[model samples]
Target: MKKIFLALLLGSPLLNFAQNKLSGVVTDSVNKPLKGVSVFLPDIHKSAVTDETGAYVLQNLPSGTVKIAFSFVGYDTDNRSIPINPGENVLDIQLQPSEFKMDEVVVSTVFNKLQSQNVMKVDHANVRQLQHKGAVTLIDGVATMPGVSQISTGTSIGKPVIRGLSGNRVLVYSQGVRLENQQFGDEHGLGLNDSGVESVEVIKGPASLLYGSDALGGVLYFNPEKFAPAQTVMADFGQKVFSNTSGSNTTLGLKTSTENLKFLVRGNYTTHSDYAVPDGDRVTNTRYNEQDFKTGIGFSNANYSGVLRYNFNALNLGIPENGISEQTHSKTPDYPRQRVYNHLLSLNNSVFLGNSKLDLDLGYIANTRSEFEETATPNLKMQLNTVNYDAKFHLPKFGRWESIVGIQGMHQSNTNKAEEFLIPDAATDDFGIFGTANYEWKSDVLQAGLRYDNRRISSEAHGIAGVEGSFKSMARSFDSFNASVGYKKNLGKPVTIRLNVASGFRAPNLAELASNGVHEGTNRYEIGDPDLKTEQNLQTDLNLEYKNDHFEFFVNGFYNFVNHYIYTAPTAAQIDDHDVLRYVQDDAALYGGEAGLHIHPHPLDWLHYETSFEMVNGKRKDGDYLPLIPANNWNNTLRAEFSLKNFTDGYASLNVSHTFGQPHVGAFETESGGYTLVNLGFGGNVKLGKAAFNVSLNGNNILGETYIAHLSRLKTDGIPNIGRNIILGVHFNL
Candidate 1:
């Protein structure tokens, strides 16, 4: 035994010499550090976790060609193969976010299996994309995606509708957890930050297989950066000033990693006064401010990995309105509202089970909102808390098919209190089981999935005795099923084709189906219908894409059939003799298509120009056109980049877009004028030894025009749109 032990110790050096140490950092689209990222080798059976600084170090790595996999709980999983040389191997990796769970992929279950191009993976917006554009909200960054449209300002209050579906039918995931705010309200902000987002992905069709309820439209996913592996510390800071709103913003980020653990932390703060029209006239009290924070940590080894993360954000809004009495002046703060805070905490683990992969995630989310009105003295408050857990297994092999199975469960509770309960306290439990399978060849692929969801809800005052304290609790149950199949083929030429057919469904929100009261925030009376059934949607889409060296284009068309659609319909009866609108259910049909073309005429590296256009039209099955949908739109952009010696990288860009507004009848038959906006930006970067300093100047609505976008909700309160704005920003990296 002693001789065997000595021989093992002596031969360990040979094993160590056969392995290589690899270390590096990962960042977001904004170049901010990320943490709690998972890095592993499937063929070699080795893995490591990133530290808080978005850094990872894998020891005992075999040399020669090896396959490496990278994944974060909230983001997409990425794989690549590289040849390891002698001594040390250093590589820096940047990971993007994902919409579907990994278990949804067949390749995840089979080792040494090759993935087809048809594996509808999530797409990420990289640094090149964000640095090339200036946006006001998250919608501005993702609205251009295939099958995605914004019906509101397309800025601050925008929500993405997938394949003619919107509102509560869609689910939004941040860092791998659902955000439970007033998602049913159009004016509700998504409460996210573009500064910290590594990237975003939109899942186009039915996703009930993994997400359970409230995913009929699809999912919007955001992933932050992971920790670095190099025992080194990095910091970045920047400030931006907007010309239109005279608004200023700032962000600070930091990352660091040690031998065993890693950490990444970032914070952002922004404040803006009322913006002006292109005419330089103040747009009154349409001012808002926001704050956001995020942090993550991870620990990992060969067989097991664990991660933890935390996030918090808040939005404060002040809207302008014309007052009836002298005491309430035009700038007297007609609308003072606050979505005080949204908080999230998460923990995840992945354990290797022979050839199978076992993963689990547990999370908790808290959302709080409050409103104070000038017309009423009391303050209204609503709070929601949710607990979620998920577990899944990736099966090794099944003939020529790969498969996965998973279980998910969530518990939610909400409470609202005020002078009168507009929305009352409610409790709900949701559980689901799902599976997916995929088969593929070199250029042809086929995939299918199915999901079953069950929900139980309990609410007070439903079929109860009285309105006062005599309320009795009522319990109800709901179930929904989702199924989808997709086919794809890639010709050796420059064109690729994909066709998909899917069915999705959404149950009415607890508040929309059971609440009966008055909301003080918007001064509106709301009534619910208990007889409403689950809303169902059937969608079919075809996509043709062409790609080459200098030009790429895509054309996609879709048709949708919906049942029991929910909408805010006008009612002849008044609450206190004041005109109002109530929630109602009706059948509807929607059809539309979005297409884009890109051309780079100049072959020279110094100059390049790109142009694209998008158009959409939709009408209800009843022939009542849907309200708030935008008309045809198009944008043209031109840019030039110059490399000066070895020290400077300079670029200048200009953009112009036209938006047409067709007539739509809202609660009051409101009509908006069509408008056009132009934007211009110029910037350059200089390398200072190992550090860099970058500066940019941008102008929005350069014409200073006074046209309101089709999505502006300001028409409801008699406020005119703002004009052109300017911004100056500076960036530093080390």
Candidate 2:
């Protein structure tokens, strides 16, 4: 018996040691499994490919300290080195999406998708993704992200909305400075172009804790890369030709980084013509054209960085008809109509102070926009000039906590025709102070913040020019406190969970509550009320993720409850032959969810797929679906890649997206119909003597089908949908 017991004990130890292994699953943004993904120790030749379920298993992985590298086509590579004892280990990784614009071989989505199990999420994107077919504006790119959408007034003008929030409920920043545009106006330009951005970060849900009052919905942060000579200079020029619209873009970039100094400067130009429909028809109510320029300089040292930038953009629209009859469809000669010009100057500085940092920003902006209809009287023009300043401090590691505190001040003045009804002639001054602190212990993170804002709005409505309208001044003051907590763990399995909730508030701006007149561009009569109050909201989010060697999936959900949510309410009255609407707020609630999956079929290295879905629903206290909310959407992608030993690399991918119809309030339309679009892409990168080139061709709407989104103002017209498009582009790194 003693001899048998000794043999059993010896065998048990060996069995336990043999069961230990290192394993993980890999996926892309859409949650699709990747195959032919190379996992290896470069110092050694141990490697493997993902199985059919997008899973990979390394058998007999030697126990010890080593690094593992992950590389796949169209995705960024990741390397993690760790020491493993004799035991089973699992690590799941989600790879960032690649861009088709700047660097074909670039890994990472247009927006930088960060890796965090926390409920608070931030994302970024570049111009290529923002300019997808039928995308006529910058906000369009943001629509592809989770918990985000665009409020469409016209193709060229769309506003970003986050979790059923927009307007004053949201804030925007460029290079860490407030964007001083007249954002209160629906037709106001985003006053930004994709050309000058090195990257864009979108903070979803209420970040009012970090930003101030306007961040109730979220904040958009833009950062431009500084020019320096790590490399002499590189240039990117692209031209896109759609069935109906044609666009041309050119960019020149320079970068230099040495021992003590780094400089980066870049400039861009773009122009586009009116778009057409699949049936050879032009939805000519509004034709678009634009020109933009930007210049930036930055200096950096071991402990500090400073940057200065200037940008200008102009937009002109031509009308094809004097007016459209509600029923008959006809084309008219192109007529000169409206134009907008904008310019901005910005400066920013930051310095490290041991465990804390100090940053400062200053900016100035000038804008002029004009509209013309009849040749009888002079055209109406609106002009604005604004300046902004901000100072902030961020402290690192104070025990288990960190803090960010800041103060901001802004002043704006507007000039316009006394009779310009839609555009308010006003002067505004604003001031705010905000602070946020974060605490972490073990697996839990807690965040808290507060902000106070004082604003004054004055208009020359009754002043005498001989006698102008009169001077009317409006002032608003408000404060908000926000807090959230998050927890994460590995639970001895692949399942992960995260939850967070926050409180936020938004102050009403002058335009949403004071403007009164015609907005011919969108064919709606608008009016505002001086009795409007600030809006307040509570938001929460939950997420769950699972991963293994062959499959990966994630689910996310959000809820928003708001008081005094402002929207335009339709009235029974009609003025100047147009329906009238008034801005008003109501108690409302919203809920939505998003999910993604990646599956790799291990039978072969050539085939793989991914799928994602987003859905949202909202209601007023009375149970009516909210207006301007996008319907549920689903997107899927499939790809096949082929590799030849030491020589050729190639791949083909197909993507399809579907959007369901949605209901709206107080409009000639109530709902938009569902539609699906498909895209086909093919190409790969090639290596040549320390240099490489990435090239691809995409055919969008391969079926040549025509369909219009219900959100399209064009739906009111019987105009057919925009036709299919094809794009061929290349990226080279030398």
Candidate 3:
């Protein structure tokens, strides 16, 4: 356990918006000055550490209440609120001894509070711990959480799936900005770097009231790394080795914070050869390389605070077209490779009024994707640019109710540069308004929200409909209203239950409305429909939890009914040298649940056992199974912990994940077989010359099983997933 101490002081109030400074000294219980004590203001993203003289200063802070947290080794964490004014102020703090228990704060929902006090059920994980487990990517680490999974084209590309919904239904928030990366395609993956990310929070059900559109399935929110403590500068370096791919991933980052300003930067690079399958044969054209960078700068004053961030990602991914071949570990990819680049910039700001606060966020994203076939020029090219904005005002609290009213919207344009046109050039605009509130009382919490949205989509003509049977110039408009209500009750000191009902809707994307010609890398030629109704759904969720020092248990269930669900399927005729498919709509329903338990006996406190299972079923109104439905899964883990004198926390775990056979599939989908894989990992932190270093070793599919996943696009080609991979990583902070 670590021990820490903190003290917050309120400075004299000032009416003007000017720079404010706070200087303080930190001392131990013995009255001796302590050096290297970390001090931070969460709301302003500015922080500093005590110098050799036990003195710390915070500059350029907003004039209002701010949350400051102090932490150090061998001390308990201290966090509290302090008022800042427009002039210089002085305060001193003393440290004390206490036991260690982490107090986590959640920010995904509008109500920013500790998870223990939040009414909504959320799943969260520490990125540092996930890194310790040697997860190669952010999605891979998130998949370990209950009810969360990823749909993969291969190791190099994947998208997140929550419960039973994926693709455009799930929303991802990064750096306080909604991520828009042409997510409608199966080959598109989240173009993000995990180097400087701090944590992840997952909402497993409908969240349309908070987020206007594309929240019908769920949400994944990523929190970037915080600024360094005041008076301190830090850097971290890490490297990982991939056995199956004969690859390497390396990252380096640095951060610094002063009185009123903070900055951080990170760079990462990855290169991998073809991935090896169960039979020791390499999957041809499965190699890739990536380069990514992220940086941020923060500034604050008495009246306002803001941070500007930028992220750039470039990848050269090989789109597999050949069969299994003799082993080759070349870095140069095959002919049919894809080159993708993304530039994202965002600004987040907060303004404090007399008794309320206003929050604003702005973001812009530019994506360029191209495919190079046999020729030197790209065979397919597409460029997408989007700008989005969000604003919210927290109303003055009245009694026990906390409320916020907000408006958010996005403007996007899509254009094609190659001769082949998959989807015509299109422009879209969407806007929404929402208000949410929470009522709190002794042992019970009530929450509700309402939202309304309008969307317009316009596409340029590609060809005449009568002769070519293709899409012409078209336009469409859609609007919908959504609402949600939830109640949380505490049964006792160790039991709790929550019930929630929510409604959500989604407007059709441009591809569904104007797509024509054959889809690259697939056998189907898709024809879009100009007339598609908006999709709407209602879901009811129930959650139960029982937790204590020795044991933990949880269960979650949900049922959803949707009207006018859109899907694409094959027709009776062939078009453009391929099987014809048409976009269609129907009513659909889906229901599923997840359950888990964890135990640690009193006498054997160092040993633990855990297990969890998840399953979902989806069907159309005609009673046909839905496509791309994930199979039922069961996971088990056994672990033991031990502490070494003069060393840090250490643990070892053995795990197994079993996926049941998927006999229920769509008309064109094939049944998948069941399979189980074993995984093992262990890691520990060590202190070396005033620096902390972490090391971990993890193994996946140790037995090298050969199997196909139901959601894999390559499954139809009888391509098995990667097998028998060992990963080793080391991270050192200085």
Model 3 ranges with Cα > 4 A deviation: 1-41, 47-103, 464-470, 688-692
For model 1, residues 302-383, the per-residue Cα lDDT tens digits are 3444566788888776544431122211222336544468888776565544445666767788888776655444366778
lDDT (tens digit, per residue) of candidate 2 on 338-383: 6778887776665545445567677888877776666524376777
Superposition TM-score, candidate 1 onto the true structure: 0.82
Model 2: lDDT to the true structure = 0.61
- Steric clashes per prediction: 30, 42, 17
Give the root-mean-square deviation of each candidate in angstroms: 8.4, 13.8, 5.7
Error of 1 at 647 (Å): 5.6
Candidate rank order under TM-score = 3, 1, 2
Model 1 ranges off by over 4 Å: 1-57, 60-116, 119-123, 144-156, 323-335, 375-378, 397-400, 462-473, 518-524, 580-582, 646-649, 664-669, 688-691
User: Cα lDDT of all candidates, in order?
Assistant: 0.65, 0.61, 0.82
lDDT of 1 at 28: 62
Compared with the true structure, the alpha-carbon lDDT of candidate 1 equals 0.65
Q: Whole-model lDDT, candidate 3? A: 0.82
